[model samples]
Target: MIYIFLAVAFSVAVSVLLKVARSRGIDIVQAVATNYVVAALLAVLLLGATPEAAIEAKATWTPLVLLGVLLPAIFLVLARSVRSVGIVRTDVAQRLSLFVSLFAAFAFLGDTLTQAKALGIALALAAVLCVLWRPERGATERGGWAAPLAVLAGFGAIDICFKLVAQAGAPFASALLASFLIAMVLCWIAVLVRAATRAAPVTARSLGFGVLLGAANFANILFYVRGHQALPNSPALVFASMNVGVVVVGTLVGAFGFKERLAPVNWLGIALAIGAIGVMASS
Candidate 1:
């Protein structure tokens, strides 16, 4: 559908933007936090001045807020991971999201688990490691190995949150609000942690970057939330595939666009990523 393609395109653009913004000396975490703020404002606007719709959407708020809390911490880290590790492996970590989400769905939402999903998870984990692994002698050895792992854990939790929030059926915008508020809280906590540790004092640059990042990040998620309505399919497939698309795009970006080269062993991770997507699609 046109909406699906639009969703994919918007998402890709966001991914590319993250990569591009880093070169501008943007603080990835701050930028992401800003994006959430921008997105939250939009969500509030969409929720409208009336109280009725907002009240009815309380169910949606809970999950969205919970997601909001988790995402900033996870995605803020992801922004760093992407910069340190490159988009390819970052995307691979995202693919593993499906496996975590699948379990959450089965356990909490009572969704049926097929053998196809299990196989997909196994392949996805392999794919993630493959993408994250760099074979070079020195610097390449540590090229975001830990970052990808952290992203893997964060994004897995994110997948389930997305599913739960999707089911909430609030104005979608309400859910976005919850997400933003939570993310804001978590991000600020990080800032506090940095400050307490006597890291650099809050600079205008960090604040500005956080604001910009939040605005764009808000746009990024708003698109995802609106995508379900725009695309008529179940959000599950759409979300999963959107993640897969990110990997493909990130890999290409790293390899060709950014000139972030990888060894043959690492390329296998990309291949496995492709395979994992196939399994997800089929499942």
Candidate 2:
């Protein structure tokens, strides 16, 4: 339970850091690059992962490379989503990515889809529609859905990649380290490309915020992974609780702390998201 709460807290803290980055006019690309580097270092120090071990794990590299490419791309998309749509919607969409993971479970992993899981997916789809539908502007708004949709799909793909990594039987810490290292290289390439194009000069402030962001991001993953390990037989509970906690807390913070306005349907979506998690967990 403490691990669950810590995961939730750190997850929310990530969104908060990105939100603050937007407020402070930080160069998010640079910050994200720095974040990967910091997270990789922390994984080495805290998780006791050796680069040599990761390098020798042949089965891990495919997912590790995919994750490396996807992590920064998704982080950029997440930052955009947080900035454009506020934390509540972004967080909801992010958690709803569980649908994709479940779909992958059924499609590629040979997991049987029970009725409850099917219904949960249906309800979650409805929740996404409701949450993203803008009031008084019809269903489609000007560029409103893009970031949220990207966040949804991006996170889902990431979840699938993690499942693949786990299936390979690599150590969690080493796998994470490998992914982070790859992500760092990819992000730095982007940073270098942008610097060459005069996008923005890298600054120390970005590095500072990135350290904070990296610590929180790694902590979130570490705690969530540890929590699941601690409750190996009750994965459903951990999944349901973690997602529910993030959605609920994100909505509250977005609404009250950030003064983001939500239509009634968005509130309904939040409720449905909670229900969907419960239903899926039961399955």
Candidate 3:
């Protein structure tokens, strides 16, 4: 439970850091690229992850590459989402993304769709729409849904790719390290391209923020893994607690700490999102 609490805290902290990055003049691209560097190093030092397993003939490069691409790309989308829609909605959308992978499981991975899972998926869909709704149409609301929706889809695809990698017999750490390295390279490429085009300048501030982001990001993964280890017989509890905790905590932070206003429908969406996770976990 403590591990789950830490994981939820770090998860929301990532969004908070991203939320504050732009106002601080942080170069998000450079920070994101640097984040992979830090994550890859931590993977090796803390997790003892090595590339040996990733190079095996049976290891699938397709999903690994997809993860590499999606991780950083979605990260950028996530930042944009936090900037546009605020953390409450963005976090709910992200947590609800399990439905995408859930549907994929039923359609492609041969997982049975139980009644509980079906109801959870339905609730998740309704939650997404509610969370994405903007009661007041204005300049700020225009195109706001795009980033959160992308966050939802992008994370769902990333989860599917992770499943594929696991199915290929690649150990979690090795797959994570490999994907981090690839994502690092891709992000650096984008950073360099932007620098060359004068779209954004790489700065020490951005690099510093990247280090913080990476630490939080890796901590989230580490604690979640530890939570599962700590409760080996209660994975569903850890899963549900982690997801529901993030939504609840993020909402509090966004609403009180940041004073972000939310409509009643948005609150309903948050409740539905929690309910969906609970239902799925029970199933």
Candidate 4:
């Protein structure tokens, strides 16, 4: 129960951090890379002298190793999509990844697909559709298939990597640590390449925002990892709940705190997300 609350809280924090980081003129890719570096460092400090132990425990670095390539690749693409597609659309596309992940987990990994899980997955789908439903006059000046399409692909890939890691015969903590490390290295390389291509000025404002992002994002990942470990059988429904929580919080913060307006359908989507999460968890 506590794990559930913590996971929701972590998702909310991530929402807040993303907005704050953007406001400070921090590049999303840079911010994400910094967060991964921070998360990797924390994992190293906490798990010290245990690489061999962790690797031995997992025996198959397959999932974590794949995450190394999968995370940075999609994340960079998602960052671009966020700017072009807008947050609402991007969130919807990412959460719609529930369908992709649930299918993969069921077909390949044999994760539980009970009625309760299906109900949860359905609610999650409703939320995604609602979030993506643009009002009649809501179209932006730009309309391109590239960004949204790429974001969807990126999210689906991420979900696949997560499901694979979950199915690996290893301690969840070890798998998590290895995955973070791999992601950290890949992101670092990306950051260097960006630095060489163009000078991204990291002002005090950017630095401060990155640090705050690192804190919240790392905390989010840590809590999520813990909740994943505590939850049995690595149900895709649980991950669906995580995405639904993000939508709920993002909508609330956007409406009240940020004064962003929502159409009627968007509001319905928010309610559906909450209700779905409620049904999925308490059933």
Candidate 5:
């Protein structure tokens, strides 16, 4: 439970840091790129991840490459979502991405489609609509829906890629490290391109924030993994607690800490998201 709490805190802290980064005019791309540097180091030092495992004969390169591509891309989208839609919607959208993976499980992964899972998917779809709702000339910035919706889909795809990597027999930590290293390379490419084009200059400040973001991001994964290891028999419990905890904590931080406003429908969406997770977990 303490691990779950820490996981939730670090998860929300990532969004908070993104929000602050935007406010402080930090180069998000550079910061995110540098984030993978710290994350990869932690994976090696703490998780004992090694690249050799990822390069073994049984491992597949396709999913690893896809994960590498999607990780930084989705991270950028997540930053945009947080900047435009605020933490509340972005976090809910991210958690609800399980629906995408759930669909894939039923359609492609040969998982049985149970009634509870079906109901959970329905609830999640409803939650997406409700959470993304913005009244005409509302408080939310214009085009706010785009980034969060992208977030929902992007994360869903990343989840599928991770599943593919697992099915390929690549150890989790190794796959993670490989993906981070790839993402770091790709991110730096983007940063250099932007700098060359005079779009954004790389700065020490962004790198510093990147280190913090990476620490929080890595801490989130570390604690969540520890929580699962701590309660190996209760995977559903850990999954439910982690998802529901992020949604609840993110909402509080967005509403009070950041003063992000939400309509009643958005509140309904949050409830529905939690209910959906509970249903899926119970199923």
Candidate 6:
């Protein structure tokens, strides 16, 4: 439970940091790139000393590569969604992505879906729709569909890929190292390209924020993995707690801290999402 709490706290912190980035005039792409570098360094420094298991963990490369490519892309989409749709809706949609991973578990991983889980999925789908619903307004004023859709699919795919790596017997540390390493390389290329072509300034602020972001990001992964390890027999409990915690925490922060407005329907959706997560986890 402590691990789950830490994971949720770190996860919410990441979202809050991103939200703060917008007002502080931060270059999020560069910050994100630096974040990857920091995360990679931390992973290597922390886990690099491990012997046999770390050396043999290269077998997980396939999924690691996919994860590396997806991580930055998804982060960008999440930022865009937060900017366009506000954190309340974006966080709900993001957490609701568990529906995709759950479906994949049943379809591809040979997991049986009980009625409770099925009902949870149904309620979750409804929640997603309600949260994303926008009242009729000027076309220019409304956020479009693309960023939210990308957020949904991107997170779902990432979850499925993680499951694949775990199923392939990859040591979590090794897999984490591989992912951060590859993502760092990719981000370096991006940062360098922008520096050459766009002359994007690299500021001390970006590095500072990136380091904070990196710490929170790495902690989120580390703690979530630790939570699963601590309760190996209760994957559903860990998953539910983590996701529901994020949604609940994010909503409060979004509403109170940021003063983001949510429609009554959106509020209802959030409530339904919590219920659905509970049902799915208990199933």
Q: What TM-score would candidate 5 get against the native?
A: 0.96
lDDT of each: 0.66, 0.89, 0.92, 0.63, 0.92, 0.83
90-193 in candidate 4: lDDT tens per residue? 55566565556665676777777888768867877777566556565453423433665566666676767666655555555566667777777777676678
What is the RMSD of candidate 5? 1.8
Native-referenced Cα lDDT, model 3: 0.92
Q: What is the C-alpha RMSD of each candidate to the true structure, in Å?
A: 4.1, 1.7, 1.7, 4.3, 1.8, 2.7
Of 1 and 3, the candidate ahead on lDDT is 3
Rank the candidate models, highest TM-score first: 3, 5, 2, 6, 1, 4
> What TM-score should be assigned to candidate 2?
0.94
Estimate the overall C-alpha local distance difference test score of candidate 6: 0.83
Question: What value of lDDT does candidate 1 attain over all alpha carbons?
Answer: 0.66
TM-score of 1: 0.77
- Candidate 5 per-residue lDDT over residues 1-283, each given as its tens digit: 9999999999999999988887797888999999999999999999999977785734458888888899988878888999888999999999999999999999999999999999999999999988888765453555877899899999999889888888878888988999899999999999999989999988999999999999999999999999999999999999999999999999999999999999999999999999999999999
Which residue ranges in model 1 land beyond 4 Å of their true spot? Answer: 1-6, 9-29, 46-66, 107-109, 137-143, 165-171, 186-204, 225-227, 233-241
TM-score of each: 0.77, 0.94, 0.96, 0.74, 0.96, 0.89
Ten residues in sequence with the least summed lDDT for candidate 1: 46-55
Off by over 4 Å in 4: 1-7, 46-49, 53-59, 73-99, 111-119, 137-156, 199-208, 224-245
Cα lDDT for residue 173, candidate 2:
83
Q: Once model 6 is optimally superposed onto the true structure by TM-score, how far is the C-alpha of residue 225 displaced, in angstroms?
A: 2.8
Residue 47 displacement (Å), model 4: 6.0
